[model samples]
Target: MSDLNRWMQKHNLCPENILYLYRSDRKTVLHRMDGGEAALYAPMHGVLSVLPEDQFLNISKGIAVNRSQIVNIGNDGVYTMSDGRTFQGRKRGLSSHRRLRMEIGLSDTKPRPMSMSLLEKCSLLDDMPLAFCVIELVFNEDGHGVDFIFRYCNAEMANIEGVPVEEMLDRSFYKVFPNGDKKWLVSYADVALNGTKHTLHDYSPEVDKYLTIHCYQPEPGYCACVLQANEP
Candidate 1:
């Protein structure tokens, strides 16, 4: 059960080690739980777009907090973290967070109990019968495709590839499938960069399976695949 803390620590404070994100001078400062801070060139919205919403609460137009760790919101507009840290919050944000928590099925009357985050349930797609994966394309300085990162894969995908899910996520795709029969860069690149949908009917020598593979862009710079095995 990997929680947000471990995930953010490994991800280098890109997400949860950050208890508070403050926007200053058009730059976002990530105030980490370990008492360190880092500056991000981008705005808070850009960073939050890729993160899970379960823990984030916008304390202001330019400030967000990890509300899951917050234990109390005082009438004086101060929020108390479970670790006894306190931050001055805005009234606009306090009301907004209460409504959001209730809408999202979290209790608004008390502190949040410790629980597994599960990457905000993004991988819940694991229940699908066919193999599914999300690959993020990597490019060189010249904007040419060099490789791709395996951002996620369902259990069915792990089974089809004969690799563990943990072994694939955030890893190089070619490293996992060293014996790839055909070069996939062209197809995947076009899909990730141009939002094109492509399908291929081919066999994977690595897994010894013939399949109809459908590739599409779920978001910019990312390709999602649904592999239906013909040999099944």
Candidate 2:
């Protein structure tokens, strides 16, 4: 484990007060408007996952700035912050936010996607405090695991991934996280394909959080995973 994982502490900050996030090596330093810094040993993208998507956008692959902190977003792929600091946001990120602006005029373009079979089995679990999701396994012709698509995601599951509930539904796990650990596919596949119920404790260096994942097959080719995370 990295030093961040060996010694993790929780820091609660108001989302609005966050000014910018800068990643140095594997540690992400949250530079606040008040000159305070909260450091987390986590991947940049992983940290971005838990922020308010509407308020935070990646300036570059290595940096994400709060929308409130931006002084102006220039047409030249550069953004200036209220703190007199400027950084280049990725063109793809800017385009995505432009698309996000387009989504404002539209309302719920599609209904939330869910798997009835998984939903039924999920109801059997009486865990109100944990985050959980039901996912369908995607496989290659060789029957090996490739990815899992979200069939049903509870609100808490969205909090875990730092995405909104509607945004996660019916989305590919790899699509959202292109470089997500392959071990996750293996773990979920073991439960879904073989009905092997199990649990695992994992520490995410990227998000600087500890996780306990409880997995079970809700139906063939589908599994439900209960997630509990903290900065302990």
Candidate 3:
């Protein structure tokens, strides 16, 4: 069976109860309610396309949040999940908000709730000036690292890549840039698996730019990177 199919069978992700399918670099995770608490299934990619459209909505570039999972929407463009974690909406003027409200069948003038958390505050990174991405390490069955996936990237990183952020979501690093150094993949895997932080000054032939990257693991199996583009 394909990895996507395997994931669906293991998670019992039926159309009836799943709240959303969130994409993070290499995986598409299922978010659902289990016994009044939010449960996230294991991450797998390529499953979103098969889900029923009437039940899911693509809220942001890489995030397809389930309509039932939404508990509140704030005037400040914060979406509060049933589990209390918040995700900021993409900034494309007021129309984005209008579109979201329309998709969820919500009135535009609804009152904004006053609940916000540190995760909501950290959503500001989406608009931050620096280039940032959350990367996940891909491993083989034998536990050897092969490539890195771009789970989440900010607008700055999209600008730096000269591509739409959507194109980078869930894409393997080597597939995106066929000429990228393989050594960087090993470095990323090391940081992700071992939880070591690293800083490197390297030149990217793909974008034809030099970059100073600070990479660290925010959790096991995932690494977050902040980079500055330098002139060659």
Candidate 4:
């Protein structure tokens, strides 16, 4: 294993999540979130003075980038990807070009992994149905309580809960519903972590609203999509 991989494992950073790699002869492992795929490229020994290339794809600068990051290529320069990822490539130096040419069989860098930022992760479930959105709240192994905190809320949930999206990041359901049944929340977390699917229907006096809360534990701390049905 590479030194980088060893270090990342120690920190619980999954190597399978790598997004990109940079190298003069080989690729450097940068972001790794797209199931061990390399999606970006960079020049070795040319970081200081390498000219961008016409064919090189451009995404945003210093963030999630891929060859597809470029939307348009012209005198106006490279444009951001449709999804807002940024990257850029301009004319390459003669030597860099030669090196790139020589390594036609070899990858310029390793697979670049896409790092799923908080916003990007949340965006994963965007536009999902209100019932489907409630599946985000999952229970733990023993069906004791909620394992993962509800980080993102769909439009329907936001309206039903009467809580703004910005207000839900990292905030647990118990905190949101302080006066609600603590035992139920704890039980929900337990079953979620343990890999079970469940749901609860009730009215939230705090929000002065009625909601149908459903949760499915797809994976530990990961598979907790929730759906909220608001009463008219």
Candidate 5:
């Protein structure tokens, strides 16, 4: 297992249990749902560096939070934690906070049943020959793009990546493929934020192959990419 995963397992830190991390004195303290705090013997930046990017939202230089633990966001850049503590972040953090709140709300909500015809029409995409996937651009609470989460992937996409669709769904793209090019990350974020289409040819170290990708936003905050494996 990776160091990050091992650290998470060592501390028993899971999404439902971890509240947030705060810098206190010379150490970084991890706050838990059970009303306990553990001081990590590392610099705040070091601790933040090891955290799973998709799971932690940095509210400020000294505060990082689990998006799921946020209860509500108030005007003037104040956020109420699930444990009822309020943290006022910088004014610049407000936009990112609101975006995170909206993303969480959408994910937690259940979609209404669609008409049978509509469902059938949507299913047609699954039969497409091209490898397809939808990615959610993750951001820090300060409004900077950090990483990406795989929201959906078709069987062809999974096969092309040599992973199961179930394994890719809702998992951090970086965690799965740590060697992914930074250029791809930039392109994904641009398409997600600007609603423009981008096409690129890149080599995937993970799959030991080259790939041609066309990326575009299906909606704000989400990117849909179609991949084609290129000749060696």
Candidate 6:
């Protein structure tokens, strides 16, 4: 057996994964892929050294990714590992992220024209911490006369709302709330959609509610829901 295989076997690494060490002033780690997994090619060349380390070690460990770096995981035990660039896991090596995805399964996928499944959109934004993904209702047109509408939301946003995201997407936002004010929804739309970014402190329409609002045009004709929770 080759030294690489012998080392990998000793380390409990998934098959098709290889470890290469580099000699540099500071120690570095490298992961090489043989199967569907992607190899970190460039950093491998500059790597100072390599060693068998757990993928859950200090955040800086090349194999140990920050929670933010993960995108999604499939039931087949494939993890969508990402660092701006995306990569996939082979088989049983996807345990950690697989569980996280399962916990948020209430946010399922729906067919969409953008070639993006609801799951993908949720997963893309959901990978971030709950604090990062913001949620809010959007309004159509310029006047307070318009009704509140369902707009875009992130994974964390779905969790906070306690409703399956498929139900939330594209629905009239005003319909969900029993006593939502049309004027406030319109003003929110004006600030968010009108290009002036605004922040609110006591913006809550109800008790125990504080929301920070920002606006951007993610696409033509649609206003992005940019909302963050305010602490009590």
What is the lDDT of every predicted structure here?
Answer: 0.67, 0.66, 0.64, 0.42, 0.70, 0.41
lDDT of 1 at 158: 77
TM-score, every prediction: 0.46, 0.45, 0.46, 0.37, 0.49, 0.37
lDDT of 3 at 16: 62
On lDDT, who's better, 1 or 4?
Answer: 1
Q: What does candidate 6's lDDT look like per residue over 1-232, in tens digits?
A: 6554454456544422432222233433334432132222334323222333433222122334323323334444333332112233344444544565556441122212322453356456655655232233222221112343454556666555555656766666556655554435434443433343445444445323667655543432234545667776
Candidate 5, clashing residue pairs?
A: none
Question: Which one wins by TM-score: 2 or 5?
Answer: 5
| 1-232: candidate 3 lDDT, tens digit per residue | 7665565667676666675556654555666644222233443224565667766767666666767655445555556554335566665565665566666754433222222452354367898899988877553332222556787788898878776888997787777887877657646755765677889889978878898999998666677889899877
Clashes of each: 0, 3, 4, 64, 0, 4
Against the true structure, candidate 1 reaches a TM-score of 0.46
Ranking by lDDT: 5, 1, 2, 3, 4, 6
Compared with the true structure, what per-residue lDDT tens digits does model 5 show for residues 120-232? 54356786888888887664443223467887677798778988888888778877887766557657766765577889898888878899999988776677889999997
Question: How do the residues 61-159 of candidate 1 rate in per-residue lDDT, one tens digit apiece?
Answer: 787888655544544455544334456666654666555445544334322222234333446788788899888765333222246778778888877
Residue 154 alpha-carbon offset, candidate 2, angstroms: 0.7
Worst-scoring 10-residue span by lDDT in model 1: 106-115
lDDT tens digits, residue span 1-232, model 4: 6554455566444423333333423443344332343321343323212213432322223332333222222222222232222233344433442343234322222221222464476566677655233223433222222323554566656766677776765566666767655445433543433465656677656676666666665443334556565665
Can you give the lDDT of residue 32 in candidate 5? 84
Tens digit per residue, CA lDDT, model 2, 1-232: 4343333334545577678999886788888765678887788777666668988877677888887555344444465554445676677656654443344321122223455664776665534567888887653322222467888777687677777768777878777666566556556766765688879888754335688888998776677888889567
Q: What is the C-alpha RMSD of each candidate to the true structure, in Å?
A: 17.6, 17.4, 16.2, 16.8, 14.9, 17.8
| Candidate topping lDDT | 5
Which candidate comes out best when scored by TM-score? 5
Order of candidate numbers by TM-score, starting with the best: 5, 3, 1, 2, 4, 6
| Regions of model 2 farther than 4 Å from truth | 1-117, 120-127, 140-145, 205-208
Off by over 4 Å in 4: 1-124, 131-148, 230-232
